[model samples]
Target: MAPNPGRLDVGAALSYGFDKFKANAGPWLGITAIVWAVGVAVFIFTFASTLTAAIAAADRGESAAVATTSGVFIVVTAFGTFVSYFVNAAFVRGALDETGGPEKPAFGRFFQLTNVPQIAVLALIWTVLTVVLSFIPFLGTLLTIVFGFLLSFSLTFLLDRNEQAVTAIKSSFDLTVKNFGPLVLLLLALAAINIVGGLLCGLGLLVTIPVSVVAINYAYRVLTGAPVSPAR
Candidate 1:
């Protein structure tokens, strides 16, 4: 629990994640896949509505109206992204807790946890930082990558464990600074899984989501010696 200097053991992390997926692949995948599908549908619906409003404003030759509409669209989009991030974090933490043998998994309860105000604030800060970093040149890309890993680590630590938000964020940052190489690899692996899963018409999401969740959860446990809870 001394911060898993070996956490960068990519093969071990992948294997542990796959093992967890194998154990509860059926139920986890089924639940997560459906949730993801619904999310995609909602996104499409929102986008269509926003686009229609924008076009209507433009047609009216009202520049101010168009600008206001665009602003609203951006705000709505940001809010949706914020909610999605927290919900996903909540689900991953809930799933990890169940698989790590501390609690029984309750999908409904996990979704409900997303309503927590702190999670929204965390998500908003994360989104703003990501957006700002993305606008930078080459250094921006590098910063974004590093920041992303840290953010993921912090979120996992915060949601899955019982640490206060400030403490979790500080600990995650410290761990990332100490193990930058391994943490980078872990982030890359998770990214690859997501890219591939998304490409497979989302069919691969069933496997990828659960596996990635377990892997990150294990990484947190190894790094922090935090007790994993059973499902709530």
Candidate 2:
């Protein structure tokens, strides 16, 4: 049974992320490089298109330019969310594989697809929620943080537990609430890690990002009493 306020050794969780990530560094780094490269390319393409549209609209009026840019921003945000899910699927599965067994992670697993319908529905719902949340400007950031925390484990639940999309979301919230304190600290630590990674001219992300994913999976497993193999 999970402890009240479920204990999660945040340090150990981070350690597990690093350790497991190290165990499968080749695939972890390679897949991350690919995903990073693709994401940057997509961002650059979308940004250039948006800028061109805004520049063209400027001839009409300032409001027209602002409106055009805003519309393009919305589309880019939604598209980015949808595409990020596929990248997430790869890392989530890789993290799970590394923690769940003794075998070395397969590089091909990074390209394998799983839980497609759930990911699609999940991405759509998340996009809608993000748009709706954006309307509550005063509290949007706080609410987003809370929701992000509560739903952090949803993907793991979907991939590792074979949960339905909605069920996975709800289950994650429920589990997270039971373990809120530890997980909150865990989240903060992850943010700090990534912040440092970013400060290192973004080169550090190749390591921190994979480590963070592994840490989150470790937290999920420990909070739920699932098995976790040490980094071997």
**Each prediction's RMSD to truth:** 3.9, 2.2
Scored by TM-score, the top model is 2
Clashes of each: 5, 0
After superposing candidate 1 on the true structure, give the runs of residues whose Cα lies further than 4 Å from its correct spot.
1-8, 60-69, 103-109, 112-115, 130-144, 226-232
lDDT of each: 0.68, 0.84
Q: Can you write out model 1's per-residue Cα lDDT over 1-232, one digit (the tens) per residue?
A: 3432333467777677787677555667666876777688769867886787777777667886678676766666666667677657766656556556544555554554532555666777877776666557899889976676776666666665655556667877888787778767887888898889989997787788887777777666655555543322
The model with the greatest lDDT is 2
The segments of candidate 2 whose C-alpha lies over 4 angstroms from its true place after superposition are 1-6
TM-score of 2: 0.92
Can you write out model 2's per-residue Cα lDDT over 1-232, one digit (the tens) per residue? 6433336899999988888887779998898898899899889978997999899899999999999988887788778877887788888888888777668678898666677899788878787777678768769877877787888888889988788889999999999888878888998999999999999999999999999988998888787878788666
